[model samples]
Each structure stands twice: as structure tokens, then as C-alpha cells.
Target chain A: MTSSWLNGRPCDGLPVHDRGLAYGDGLFETIRVAGGQARLLDRHLQRLSNGCRRLAIPMDTDDLRNELTRFFQVLGQGVAKLIITRGTGQRGYALPEPCQPQRLLLGSPLPAYPPQNALSGIRLFPCETRLAEQPRLAGIKHLNRLEQVLARAEWRDPVYAEGLMRDMSGRVVEGVFSNLFMVVDGELRTASLVRCGVAGVMRGEIMVRASQHGLAVVEGDISYVELLQADEVFLCNSLYGIWPVTGLAERVWPVGPLTRKLQAVVADLLSDS
Target chain B: MTSSWLNGRPCDGLPVHDRGLAYGDGLFETIRVAGGQARLLDRHLQRLSNGCRRLAIPMDTDDLRNELTRFFQVLGQGVAKLIITRGTGQRGYALPEPCQPQRLLLGSPLPAYPPQNALSGIRLFPCETRLAEQPRLAGIKHLNRLEQVLARAEWRDPVYAEGLMRDMSGRVVEGVFSNLFMVVDGELRTASLVRCGVAGVMRGEIMVRASQHGLAVVEGDISYVELLQADEVFLCNSLYGIWPVTGLAERVWPVGPLTRKLQAVVADLLSDS
Candidate 1:
């Protein structure tokens, strides 16, 4: 069984009526760890706080920082999950007055991905799963992930690594968990999160990296043609760091130099985390 | 505490790593019970099974039916929540191999809409919250309800009965928990589920009733203008049946005759259940 920590207390089970299970009223951030520290921890907390404000869930950053520090202090190195729910509420649709705000800090062992797959890249299926545009919940990693979970369940083979999703308008949005980054017209571009998509932490980091290198960054509809024309492509999330994609659907390409350089940068961040 | 039943077993607690909490990878149906019987039991079950198939969650309906029958036999009269999740699995984004299905049935106290709210109709706020379109997950009563929960949380006044949502395109969708039916241009119309709305159980029943009465039923984009132009507007869910809207945004309307008549139709079915 997986271990758990509810509100900083060790617990074998969740309380009777966790709203996370009841209504999915919560936000989450999955992070990677190296050398006993979470990569981009501050940025993730910033995103979490921003989400809480938009959703009206109160957040205590000081307490959160301390709890998270202590959480990772014991883990040594691995992945950590921060889940904050609207907490328990009375039986109704209305947000309970005086939200008790539940917190769950979980640590898990990371799976090993072969270096070959990491370098040569993996296959991605262009999933028919379309993300609905909800700007309020867009950009934040919340608990309403059933759409992605269902899309991922569409396949069973380990041959496929991840699926690419598009918004209602058929514009490429993101991977089920990771953000999509591609090089098009000698420029780095990622799908816009203005309407629908998670503003991934790693995506943000990559944007900063691109800026540091003075690379032109575009944010808009990324079509199939643009994707195929791209010199390199990679999918990124906190856990996997960065994985270059060799192909998606029937289209195939060799792992380009840019993808490798980006991976090396991400690896450095991981090494120092 | 609210009462609960899991797989016909007696009272207990939830597992630490329920997929429902992890990924919202589950489907739920809220059944209305009156004197040892569920309202629209067959329809709700059909939806549950359809959702399981779409999510690739294998469920033995006969086994579930037996458990459900036993649960209701004990509760007699109340609301029973049937929850089916993709079961427990190792962490990460991947779908579980040989998926384990977990069915949880929880009995909740049936809520009665306030007599005043029911009779005089209720006020609804046009929520800034928009429903993202994920047709694959749309219409089904899945556990990824963070959107609805967030929309409902957009306001906290007990004075407001519910909140109305829109799609990314600014088209009116439905109330947080119910399907919207409006009389536009002297004809009946409801928000289309093709993009991002739910095909609610009560919505289906209302459609049938509308057909029997020879009312024109148009399923399409419902704008705020269409809502304003409507002579009558009402919300429908399996539990509350049908509720008329007395006020919205800057406009107001008395509960109309057609709304009352259609509500009576739903009332008869619930009484039968």
C-alpha cells in the first residue's frame, strides 16, 4: 500500500469525507527531487498560491514551505506530491463556509526510464481526447484530471509513452501530464495556456531557459504541419524532467541537437536540485 | 456523519490510494430513492455502465446490481451514490494493467429544496467559471467534478440557489448540478452537449416529455441573449427533479406555466420511483 500524510500527520487512511474524493475541489503539484531537494520548488509553490487565490482556497505559504522542506528532508531523493483540497464539507454543492482546507503531502519512488528511450525518444499517439477550455481552472494542476486519465487509459501498451491533447478548437494543447515544446521556423514555441492547458512548471522553466538563450518564443495554435516541420520536439513534466519525442502518430524524426541541449540543461537542474 | 455502503458491505473507510482521489478516474451516479426504490434506476445504471466502458473500467453490473439492491433495501429512502473507480494501481500517469475496479456506494441524506425556493423559483448567478469541453468526459457523471465544485464556489450566499456556467466561447451551458432548458423564440431549447455540456439524466427525461407534448426541442449553443429572451427557464437534475429560475444577471422572470407543467411530469416519475 502507498504511504500517506494528511495535514502533516501520518495516517493509514483518509478522513471520512475528504472533498478531494467527494468533489475533486483541490490543486496539486508533482515535483522531481535530486540531491534531496525539489527542483523548482519555489515556482511550484507560486503556482499553487496563484491557483488558491483564483479558486478562493486559503493558502498558508509559510506553513507550506516548512512542511514541504521537512517532507523532502526525510525523503533523501525522489518525487513529491503536494495536494491541497477544499477539504471536507457538509453534504451539498455549495462550498462549506469556513473551508477547513485539507493538505496531503505524499512521497513516491520514481520509475526508471531507460537512457535509450530518454535519448532516442518515445512514441506519442495524437489522442482524440480534446480538453475543454475553462480559463479559471486552466494553467493550474488541479485534481480534475479524469479527462487525461481516461485519455491515457485508451492504450495499454508500454510501447507508447504519452498522448498529445488538443483543445476544443483542435489546436494542440499539451501532453496528458507534460507540456509540449517544439522548435518551429528556427524558434521555440509552446501551446498557449490562455484558454485551456496547464502552465507546466517545466514549461515555464524552459521558457526562461529559451529567454536566457535569446530564443524567440511563440504562444498560439500549434498545428500538425508546424509540429512536423519543427526541427526538434520534447515533452516535459517535473517527474520525467525532459523526454525528446522521436515521433507522434505516423510522423517520425530523429532526436535533434536542440532537444539534447535542453535535456542537458534540465539534467543539470535535476543534478543540483 | 453521512451514511455509506461499499459493495454491499457494512460501514467502513476508504483506501488511502483510491484512484477516485488520485486521478478522478471514476464515474458516479446520484440515485434518488423513495420508499426502498431508486428514481430512474435503469437509466442511471445504463449511464454508469456506458461510462465504465468508455473509461475501460470493467464492472460486473449484476454483481453491482445485487449490492445496490441490498443497499437500498437497508436505507429505504435517501440518495445513494454509486462510485466506480479504476481501482488501485502503482503511481504515475500510466493506466493500471489488468485494471482493478472498485465500486463504492454511499448513502446520503436526501436534500429537499427549500419550499420557498421551489415554489417561487430560485436566483442563479452567471458564474465567471466556464466548463472546458472534453467530449470524451462530457455528459457522464464522472468524479472529475472540480469544475462544478469550483463554479458552485464562485459565490457563497445562501440567497443564490445555483450558478450558471458558460463554455470557452461564452455560450451558456448549465447550472453547476443541473441541465438548463429555456424557452427561446417561443420554442424549447437546451444547451448542446456536443461541445462541453452534460447530457444529464433529467435532461433526457425532459426531452422525452417535451416530445410527448409536441414542444420544439432544439439542442444548440445557448447564449446569454438567448437566456434573456427566453420566456421561461428551468434547471433539471435527477435529485431535485426540475427547478425554475426566477432571476438571472440583470433580468428577472416569474416561474412560467410550462415550467410548472413539465416539473409536474418529473414529480410523477419521482413519485413512481
Candidate 2:
């Protein structure tokens, strides 16, 4: 069952003039819930706050946290999707003066994925839809995600678990719904988010954990050639933890030790509370 | 007063799971309604139809036209805004299977602009916000318009009637709410929509009318330096018709003969029906 709230009230609809729908003037976060708690909630909130600041949307994070605490009790063990919009506005693109940001929270059952996706591994589709270079809108998870929707639409075959997207400059950036990482010659590497792509919560956590474990994690350009030449590649998101990418097109890879170690870290983090 | 309809029903709200709000997975068109008629509606519908095709959003244009005829009568003389979204969906970026497209029609009073804007011309603000190049999403108006919102926000000073935006490569594209054109060396020029920009219905009309009158209408890249060197500049949209650009930062131009010619064409087009 799915439950939702608008501004702390149990509602399933928003005003037609809401800027979130009018111009996609908003930000969103999809958080994992386990043991009646929102996992990595601080990171999610931090990202949300950052996005709000970047877009100039006023938000009271303290109040948001309080509301989520109550919401988690109702959600229990599931996924919490939160959207913060500039709220209802008069016609036009000009930011509403004295903007009243709307907070929407929805709790839904965790998506069921095949067990083999985490164990044996999953296949990746090379998406033709390229991420446009826009440093101004890069990193933070804003609502302007047509590129992602188009990329995900490129395939319907269940054999490919995810689609890999490259930037306009032909650099391997990320998956349709997750951040990507590859183990390259003993160095852990991921594409830089300076030009484009979302700076995912799990991606950040993995970087920190890898660094603490004395691993060299680099964030920079990763070409398709460089990615295919890597020792191992993996994908990560807040909900599913980490998915080992075993195949892309005709190439195949065995689950590497580095990916296993990081997956274990994510599992421990998510299972704790 | 502003009134709205959802899926041909008199409603003011939508389900929270709408992909329009979630991912900006939709297209929208703002049309001018005059004398109980939707002016230049066929062109607007054509653009919307083209957008729906590119996004793979199933739409019946004939059905949409029938609905608008009734809506225009109710609207009388005002602006008709239509939004076609991918409708409600489960949490994910992938296109919904068996998708139900939502048609939202909003009728609101025409925006009141300074009379001097049309008579004497208007000043333009060169926006710092740069449009990202994406061929797949260019020309057709989509809902992911954070860039426009940000650019419009750059100037609250009413002295500047509109803001001009360029692409990442520093090629001047369009106005915050209108399409831009310039006259250089006796030839009409507008930024090509192949890279990135909303190809406004009025822009298309102006090009055709100019060609009919035996004027050289060209669509290609326009650099800031080239724009500054142009003999005449103007901005246009379906609602406001045409506003000759009298000034940009530290520069000014008289409303030239060609601008007057095109403005007359737009004025006649909007006044009829």
C-alpha cells in the first residue's frame, strides 16, 4: 500500500498551479526505509537543502525533519519519496515573490528486484540519450529529468537491468537511475559531476568508505573505452544499495573484490537501523 | 480569474504521482485567445503534436481541437494554456506502460504589458543563464524549464521587459518568454533551434510572413557581438505579438523599417480571429 501527505496533511493531490508541475520548479529525494527508520536521511536532507539553496527555494529543514519522523512511523519499512516545490504560483516563469515551498511525502513498498542482481550481477544497456553539459544544474537532484526518462525508455527488455548514459562530450557519466563506478588498475573511479549528472547519496557514501579503507577513489572523466577496459564496474543508488554490473553489450565481468567490499559496507549501513 | 480542466473534466488538481510533477515528463503550449477564438491555434497544435511525437506521448489532436473549441467559447478573450503530461505513474524514471496522457487546459486573463512596449519598443536584459545544448529536446516546448525560471529571476526590475538567453557555446538563443530575431545586412536572422531553444509559434509565423513578403529570413547561430552589430532587433511570442528591442546593456537601436514590417504582420495576425 502507498500513503502520501501534502504539507503534513494526508492528501494525494496538489493544486494545479503548483510550480512543481507548471515548470518543474522543485527538487526531490528518494530515501530507503528500514526497521521503521529512514536510511541515510541526513545525507538526503543535506542534498535536498543544497538543491533548495541552489534553486533559491526557501525551506525549513528542521520542520521537514520533524514531519519525516512522524511520517516514518506511518511508513514503517518501505521507501520514502519527498518532493519540495516552489508551491502554487501565478502564470509565468518568474519566481513567486515570498515563495511558499510545498513539502510532499509518499511512502511506498520497496521495489522487488531479483536476488541475482545483487549476487551474480546485472546487465547494462548503453543509452543513446546523452546528458547535456550544464554545470549550473548538475549534481543536485532537481526535477528536470527528461534526459533520464528518455534514456530509461530506450529499452524494455528485462535482460538489461539498467542503462548507462554518457555526457554530450562522450564521457561515461552514470546510469539512468544510479551513479556508476569502475575499478581501474587498482584505482576506484567515477565520472565527475561538475559538467552533468546527479551527485547521488550512495555514491558519496561509497567514496568516503573507500577512502577510509585506504583506496584511491577518483572522480573525473571516464570514456566508454576507459570504462570497458576497467577491471570491474558497479552501480549504486539509495534504495537498492549496490548492483554489480557484470555485462555491457557483449563484454562480461566477474564480481570483483572491491565491489564486494563496498557492497558489504552498504549492506551494513542499511541493515543497522 | 483563472480556470482549469483536467482530462476534459472541470478539476483543479491532479494525483501526486503525476510524471509531469515528478520528472517534467510532459509538453505545454501557451496560446492567445481572441474574440472567442484560439488565434494561431493550428500552429500551436502542430508544435504540441510534434512534441508529443518526439516524447512518445500518445495524443489525439482532433480530440484536443474539439475540446479547445468549447474551451475558447468559455474563455472568450484571454490566454489559453494547455499542458499534456504523461499522467500518473509509479515511482521510476521509466515510461509508464499503457500510459494515460493528461490534458490540462487553463484559461486566464491576458498578461497586461506596457503599451509603450508595443509602440516605442522594449529594453532587453542579457541573462547570464546559458541554455544547455540537447538536440533531441530542442525546438519543442517541454516542461523542464528551470533555466528559463532562473533567467527570468535574474531581473525583477520591470524596466527590462524580457531577458535574452544563449547556449553553452555563447550563441544567443531566445528570450526568457519569447523568441528573438535580428536584421543584419538586409537579411532577417534568428537563432537556429537545432541546438537548444523553444521554437515559438510566432517565430514560425514571422519567418513565413517575411518570406511571403520577399524578405531574406535566415535561422542560424547568433553571437552576442553579431547581435550587437545588427541593424534591428526584436522579440516575439503568440500572446504579446511583437516588441522591437530598443536597447540591450550599453547599447540602443531605433525601430528599423523591417522590424516595423514584421510587427505589422504579427499585429494583423493576432487581431484577426
Candidate 3:
């Protein structure tokens, strides 16, 4: 069963005139819940707050915290999606005179993925769709995700778990929904999201944990050649934690030691009280 | 009074699961209705069809024509918005299988713009926000319009009637919601929408009419220097036919003869039975 709420009230439908539908004037957060608690919710909220501030979308963080707590308690164990829209507006691109932000909280059962995905690893499909570099909208998980929709639609084969996307300049950015990390010369490197790609919550956590573990982390452009030459590669998101990229195109890599260590670290975090 | 409908039925709210709101995976047309008819509706429909085709969204042009005609009949005079979404889907970026498009038809009274906006000219603000270059998504008026929303929000002063946006490469693209044209040495030039910007219906109509008028029309990059050096400049949308840009920043131009001529041409086209 799924639980849904709109603007602190229970509802199934959103106003057709909502600017979120009209112009994608909104941001969303897909959070993982374990043992009746939302994992890294503070990080998610931090990113959402930052996005709202940058976009000038009004946000009541205190109220959101209360709502999230109440919603998570009812949800128990599942995935929670929080969508905050600019709400209904007059027919124009301009911000409404009095903007009442719309909050949509939804809960759904965790998707079942093969255990092998985390254990052995998954194959990657290099998508042809190149992400446009827009600093203003980049790094924020906003509603303008048509590029991702197009990239994800590039393949139908289930053998390829996720597709990797690059920017217009041919710099490997990230996976369709997850962040990418590669270990080169005993150093962890992830694509910088300053120009494009979402600055994922799990990505931030992994970077922090990696740094704490005395592993050198670097964030910069990763070309296709650099990615292929990397000793180890992996894809990660809040829900899935981490998945070693065993194969991409013709190049293949065994589940490396770092990948196993990172996975174990994330697994421990997920299980913690 | 405002009238709204979702998928042909009178309703104010859309299904919460609509992909339009979820991902802005949709197309929309803001059409002008005058004398109980949706003016330039064929052009709008044609553009919408092209957009749907480019995005691989399903379209029933015949059904849309019938719905538009029926919707126009309900409202004597005003602006009608037709939003076509990819409908509901599972929580992922992938296209939903056996997709059913949802059509939302809404009507609102015509906005009250100053009569002088068309008679004399309007001021333009060069927005700091740059449009991201995305060829696959450019030209087509897809629902992902956060850039335009951000551009429009850059200014609060009513003195500037519209905001002009340039792409990441610093080529002047278009106004927030309209197409831009400049007359340089008796030749007309507008930025090519190959990389970005919406190809406005009125802009298309103007180009066709300009060629018929024996004017040389060029669709290419328009630099900021080229803009300031132009003899005449104007912005056009289907709803707001044509508005000569009298001033942009500190640069000023008198209402040139070509601007007057184009306005007269658009006026004649709108008055046609």
C-alpha cells in the first residue's frame, strides 16, 4: 500500500494549473527509509533547502521536518518522495505575486533489485544523450529532468542496468539517476557537478566517508578514456547505496577491493540504529 | 470566469501521477482566442505535432483538432492553454509502456497589457541567466522551461517589458517567451534555434511573411554587438503579435519602418476571418 499527502493534507491529485506541471518550477527528493527511519534525511533536506534558496522557492524547513517525521512514522519501511512545487500560478513565466509552495509526499514499497547487483556488479550502457551544462540548474535535483528521461529511454535491454551520460564537451557526468565514482591510482575521483549533473546525497556521504577512511577523493572532469582506464568504477544513489560497474561497453572490471570496502561501509550505515 | 478541463472532462486537478508534473515530460501551447476562434491554431497544432514527434510522444492530431475546436467554442475570447502530458508512469525516468497521453485544456481572460507596448515599443532587459544549448530539446516547446522561469525572475522592475536570453556560448537566443528579430543593414536576422530556444509560431509566420515581402532573412548567431548595431529590433509571440524593442540596456532605437510594417502585417493576419 502507498500513502500520499499534498500540502500536509491527504490527497491523490494535484491542481492541473500547478506551475510544477506547467513549467517544471519545482524540486524533488527521493529518500530511502530503513527501520521506520529515513536515512540521511538531514542531507536530503540540506540539498533541498539549498535548491530552494538558489531557485528563490520559499521553504519552511521546520514544517517540512515535522511533516517528514510524521510521514515516515506512518510509512515504516519504504521509499519516500517529496516534491515541492511553486504551486498554482497565473498564466506566465513570472513568479506569482503570493506564491504558496505545494508539497507532495508519497510513500511506496522499496523496489526489488537482484542481490547480484550489489554482490557481483552491474553492466553499464553508455548513452548517446549528452547533458547540457547549465550551472544555474546543475547539481540541484529539480523537476527539469527531460534529459534523463530521454537518456534512460535509450535502451530496452535489462542486462544494462543504468546508462552513463556525458556533457556537451564529452566529459562523463553521471549515471541516469546515480552518481559515478572511479578509483584511479588508489585515488577516488567523481565527476564535478559544478556545471551539470545532480549532486546526489549518497554521493556526498560516500565522499565524506571515503575521506574519513584516508582515501584521497578528487572531483573533476572524467573523459570517456579516463573512465575506461580507471582501475575501479561504481554507480551509487541513496536507495541503491552502491553498485560496482563490472562492465561498460566492451571494457570490463572485476569488483575491486575499494568497491567492496565502500559497499560494506554503506551497508553498515544503512543497518545502523 | 476561468474554465479548466483535464482530458476533456471539466476538472481543476490532475492526477498526482501525471508525468507532466513529475518530470515535465510534456508539451504545451498557449493559444490566443479572438472572435470565438483560436487564432493561428493550425500553426500552434503544427508546432505541437513537431514537438511531440521530436520527443517521441504520441499524438492524435485529429483528436486534438476536435478538442481544440470544441474548447474554443466554449470561450468566446481569451487565451486557451493546451497541455499534453506523457500521462502516468512508474516512478522512474523510463517511458511508461503502452503510454496514454493526457490533454489538459484551460482558459483564462486576456491579460491587460499597456496599449503603448505594441503602438510605440517596449524596453528589454538583458538577463544574466544564459540558456543551455540542447539541440535535441531546442526549437520544440517542451514543458521543461525552468530557464525561462529563472530568466523572467531576474528582474522585478516593470520598466523592462521583456528579458532577452543568450545561450551558454554568448549568442543572443530569444526573449523569455518570444522570438527576437533584428534588422541589420536591411537584412533580417534571428538566432538559430538549432542549439536552444523555442521556435515561436509567430516567429515562423513572420519569417514566411518577411520572405514574401522580399526581405533577406538569416537564421544564425546574433552577438550582443550585432544587436546594439541593428537598425530595428522586435519580439513576437502568437499572443502578443509583435512589439518593437525601443530600448535594450542603454542602447535606444526609434520605431523603424520595418517594425511598423511587420506590426501592420501581423495585425492584418489576426483580423482575417
Model 3 lDDT per residue over A59-175, tens place: 999999999998988888888999999998878999997999999998888777787988999999999999999999999999999999899999999999899999999999999
Docking outcome class, model 2: high
**lDDT (Cα, tens digit) per residue for candidate 3, span B137-187:** 999999999999999999999989899999998999999988999999898
Native-referenced TM-scores of chain A, all candidate models: 0.95, 0.98, 0.98
Q: Per candidate, chain B TM-score?
A: 0.95, 0.98, 0.98
Tens digits of per-residue lDDT for model 1, B153-205: 77877778889998877899888888999986668899888667667888988
The TM-score measured for candidate 3 stands at: 0.98
In candidate 2, how many Å is residue B9 off?
A: 1.0
DockQ of each: 0.67, 0.88, 0.85
Fnat of the models, one by one?
A: 0.80, 0.87, 0.83
Instruction: Order the candidates by DockQ, highest first.
Output: 2, 3, 1
Which residue pairs collide in model 3, if any? none
How displaced is residue B6 in candidate 1, in Å? 2.9
What overall lDDT, based on C-alpha atoms, would model 3 receive against the true structure? 0.91
Give the lDDT of residue B210 in candidate 3. Answer: 91
